[model samples]
Target: MVSQVVWAQVRSKAGRLVERPVRELRGERLEEYEAVWQPPRYQGRRAIATWWRPADRARHVGCAHLGALGAAVSLEADRDVVAFASWPMRLHWADDAGGYVPDFFVRLADGRVRLLVCRPAGGSPQRWEAAAELLEAAGKQADWQVHVHEGTADPVVFSNLQRLSRWRHTRLADADTARVLRKVFAEPQPLAVGVRESGLPELPTVAKAHHLIWTRKLLIDWSSPYMPHRSLVWAPEGVV
Candidate 1:
């Protein structure tokens, strides 16, 4: 038996409503949907709506809750994620029996689109399984990837990402300092040593190093807790 095709309802940046079959969603039309779809405001008492501005994107991405915010943080730090938006569209079955709004729509460096759903830690996964399956089916029709983020498993990694995110702004980047730091860590070295070796002002150099790490120009063991003086830092592959 042939499964029913899914439908997508999207709002343009100019506030226009568009509805179409998921298979027909591509090219310019898909770009329009990703560029302008805004997430509905959160009204519940528990989770607060928030906004996050990533260095890679010009506009702030709205997040419905902290778990979504965390997912955004991880996306910002990902080198492959070229762009993303929140709640970019709604999906429904052919008969419109039910619908879902995904947490994020991501554009990868290789030109792939992804739909992400965030379920915070401690939330029951079973509750979202059915909806996720539906979203997955819709995504498959649209040739987009689908995933559900269940919060970070490692508190230390989450804490590290949160700390590094503070330095994610482009203002902290310095080409000369980055070059020097990358050279200093061509081999594995302590975070303090590389920063000191940059031969720049101590405070500014430290911030730049953290920024480079956040951008993945300088690599660190994400599984390890970040430390100012002790954590090992190194250049990524292909960096001399």
Candidate 2:
């Protein structure tokens, strides 16, 4: 509660320096984008994607880039981000040469704007810290909360999450099959064993499990590789 009051005070201080949304730009930056590059590119891949969130996700783009690291970052965005954009936001200061456009503009669960830059371990460039300082100052002036994401999660965990994310949209068509799988998962055990002992058709049973994991009705160790023969999962409310 104290933190909420503090944030409110900060927002009050910001006092509408800029009226536009964070993702939109006016004047010089818009002109350069419209008349010059047309679209931003990272490793020949223009930043674009439909977000995973259900509320008007189709109309909102979530990220942009074309590389392995970019792909990993995009996955993290879909799984963990509340909302985001790729190179669509910029911040300019009066004395600076020009505006600064970071790699990503992320809105986290806490209502803080994160200027995310994905870089290799031990390879951070000096410009990032400079931009971070500038953006922080801008936020402070406006009484908005801003954060800089300079580090990444564990690679193994990232890869594991990526693999499981493939099943995020999976669903089961057969009601009976889904029921059986739910019963099987009600008691935590290896999925392969559940399929075998339940005497349900292996193919269909496994498909329903994918849906469960996707919906988070079934929880697994997202930080480790999914062991098809041995990952443990169960229903919510400490059922496992």
Candidate 3:
């Protein structure tokens, strides 16, 4: 009862200070079903399909990358693990599933699950911190291991590294740190192969150069291999 009262007070105070609906800019809508990249690179329906869709080749490839990383590090470690991306968490309302979700979900061979929250570096720090706290609180009641990864130097490996940073090497049971090292430091081959096989390399000059991949309903155009662009917003109605 005391804890609930304290939480209510905290929530009331937070509501007074935090911004309600945070918005990020994508690109101008060219038509009802299309969005032209203001600069032509990672803004259209294709780009969204490529990076955001769970079934997209790139997204699956990322999962493989995480798994491979875990497997590789297991060779010299004492842990058994499996890793994947976009493992959505069911949000609960008063006791049922709520719409809020967490990003990555990792499971150990023994069945323990960990919820990972990853935020790209260039995002609003305040919101990122708030999100981390929210996930942590949710984990406390849900019995899942919770973690947050912050984007730093490269967006490509942002979440991988941020979550890896939590371990206190001194407290790690083994020097290998299987989970940490595997996730944040995996090889780039899997991603490259999947991207090429997706016909990303055979597309037209503009599409290829912009990293656009065609999907049944949309196009994911304009992605960068370098810095992270955690800044993304949903498309408007009638605009892809």
The lDDT leader among the candidates is 1
> For residues 22-97, could you state the per-residue lDDT of candidate 3 as single tens digits?
0110121101111111112444423221222221123331122233333222211223434344423233233221
Q: TM-scores for all candidates?
A: 0.83, 0.59, 0.32
TM-score of 1: 0.83
Give candidate 1 misplaced runs (Cα > 4 Å): 28-44, 120-130, 186-189, 236-240
| Residue runs of model 3 more than 4 Å from their true location after superposition | 1-79, 83-85, 90-100, 150-240
Best first by TM-score, ranked: 1, 2, 3
RMSD of each: 3.2, 8.7, 19.9
Worst 10 residues of 3 by lDDT: 22-31
Model 2 TM-score relative to the real fold: 0.59
**Model 2 spans with C-alpha error above 4 angstroms:** 1-56, 59-80, 109-112, 119-126, 142-145, 170-179, 196-205, 237-240
Greater-TM-score candidate between 1 and 2:
1
Inter-residue clash pairs, candidate 1: none
lDDT digits (tens) for residues 212-240 of candidate 2: 67656666777767787888876566433
Query: What is the alpha-carbon lDDT for the whole of candidate 3?
Result: 0.31
- Clash counts for the predictions, in order: 0, 2, 13
- The lDDT for every candidate, in the order shown, is 0.79, 0.51, 0.31
User: Which candidate should be chosen as best, given TM-score against the real structure?
Assistant: 1
